[model samples]
Target: MTGTTPTAWQQRIDTLLHALADARRDAAAAQAREVALLAEAVEIAQAMAQDAGGPTSVADIPMRSLAAQIGAAARVSDRTVQKHMSDAVVLVERFPATFATWAAGDISRGHVRVVVDAGVGIDDNAARAVFEDAALEVARRETPGRLKPAARLLATRLHLVPLQERHTAAATKREVWVRDLDDGMAELIAILPAAIAHGIRDRLDQYARRVIDARDTTDTRPTDARRISEVRADVFADLLLTGHASPDVSNDAIPADEAIIARVQVTVPALTAVGADDTPAELIGKGPIDTATALRLAGTATGWDRVLTHPVTGTVLAIDRYRPSDHLKRTLRVRDEHCRFPGCRIPTYRSDIDHTTAREHDGPTELTNLAHLCRRHHTLKHHSAWRVRQTPDGILHWTSPTGRHYPEHPARTLVFTTEQAGADIQTGAVSESATASDPPPS
Candidate 1:
């Protein structure tokens, strides 16, 4: 009924496969002849894929359906089926032409998936090419069994380099701290290389995600040197489990040495309870405090809530203005080890504190309202509507001026670039050499 005709190669392979099926059917009916060749044919097909730089095992499949199919056909367990399928893949790669002919139109999505999975072993382009070419040749020939030797021989001739396995001693140790904003927090020091700092931040992101994703939303995890606030509980219970928490006195909340001014929340009744002689310290953003001012604050307010300087200043830059209870300084250090703005990689602990919402707008000084944007990003946010906000679910939402939103996850992959002496000297830091390298996915 159909006018369309199949390609010559397709038709030929289809016929061979049909014949093989018929033979298997006959064997099943008679129950006298061996069906080993049916399995051998499938094995040969898989080998050809491997030889052609495709997957040869069931592990490649996120859902190992191929292994299931093999198990069903062989009347074996799924694991057993996978083993045979893997062997078949290896064999087919060795004998390309034979396996290629039978698989002409059988390259279904599942088949492709299996092939890709098996090819994980083949890293180099040249070796992958050999496997690919062999698969094509076998598909054209539709040959099986004897063809496997060719793939094995091809693999032998090829210089298959072993993949790298490095032990990074650097990741074994980590140092994080939280303290008051001292002169060190303001005065600059030698900064780490941006790329290196980014790599470290990426690694930390990976660690946090693995643990954090498991936790339910609405619950926040503590970051910074004060993560130990839970071990001792001077902070609130609900705030303890939240992603943001305040530091305890033992955990770097040192005594105020300089009579530096800060804001405090006082109860209205409590303020009135204070004696007439009681005088409060100078109010931050407001002028100095006297008995009259204290009495006024005590009378007007239920309790006193003001900012005070902590003795220590190890990691924290400053307390957020609006959300005094929440730690905005530490959030930046954890979210972006360096600046989140593109290209600039200033360490967050060293960077300036920025408000996602302007002081003019009533943005709270919470983790949601603050980001550890580097100086460049701080300027960009001030000048441009390139908005950066954190979702309650702990994701950075960056919207362009055009109103396009991009949700960015922390980078996890590490890229190592080496320079080779050549005509193309792209960057000054590292030479862009086409070395035999296969860095993992970023």
Candidate 2:
């Protein structure tokens, strides 16, 4: 029998497989290049250490100058350069086998990183070598995620100190930290004992369920429900701020009618608010939230404002278009979402609505004349060589000091429609359509 020609689908599959293999090979080669760079950094650090008349140990090396040199050369942060230098030293001197594997394209940088992290605290050279030897095999066979836990387990068993003593030492390091994020958001991180952390998470989950139950049974609004994740977050905040689990009810010691209302600005579609549509709502500082959460928030709102937008484009169609007033400010706040400067994510609530053209230069007090800018960027606009212009569609164009130009459009929530949903199912293509509109700023 004659050999069969490959089908079109089979040829496509072959092409895809070849492409995937090429990508993997390229990634491995990149990892090898990184290892080389790290080796160079280690040498440079060692030389700096010697020049400083420090001890022969890599740990004693003056990292500040070394990091500065590496950072300038690599165009990376000094902290990043320092981390790379440290990782390189470990790979070159301590985890030789793992490094060899990574250099040879047999394993990735992630695998090497796992081996290094796992071998921490193993001071004895022989023990470290043993740990690396065991980890290398797992790295070759398993994903980084699986290899990490296995390597960690091996290190724990090989550690010379008792586990209880390690636990006691670690307990002293337990702490909490807060990090400010863009869009007026923040992250609260807690480092606690595993059992205690899990207990906190579990309790939050339970309270979230209760909140969900209360909303489903008692709240009649369409947008009042929240995702489990949102509910858990709310519960966590409540516990931290007021020692309460639910925002709708006070603690057992406080009266039920005295429940403190949580105040947040959410812009929901009129159709969604009245149960005609389920479009997602935009939380002023937090971006888009599910319709249920929006409804729940709206239900507790003490005041309401009606903003209209174009049906198809979702652009704000109606605003106090007459002058620079509070109404125009509110419209700009809802429209811009965040600072209009390129790459600046300061939320509108914390930003200033500034005129693109100077008022002294005869700039009109019109919707198209305004843009939201964070305080920092606002000052930069007036004092530096940065220039800004706004288009009729409310898109802002920025020209930097170096003449680099950037275009920024208002942030809009995504609305999933029935037609789009069906198209996604049939063609495996999901489309994102803007769900909100902004009026031009005065």
Q: Write the per-residue lDDT of candidate 2 for residues 324-391, one digit (tens) a residue.
A: 34767766776676788875666675578798888999998878998889999999999976788988
Residue 232 lDDT, candidate 1, scale 0-100: 26
Off by over 4 Å in 1: 1-328, 342-344, 410-442
Q: Which number leads on TM-score? A: 2
Q: How many residue pairs clash in each candidate?
A: 59, 11
Per-residue lDDT, model 1, residue 140, is 29
Q: After superposition, how far is residue 374 of candidate 2 from its true place, in Å?
A: 44
- The stretch of ten residues in a row with the least summed lDDT in candidate 1 is 431-440
Report model 2's TM-score to 2 decimal places: 0.48
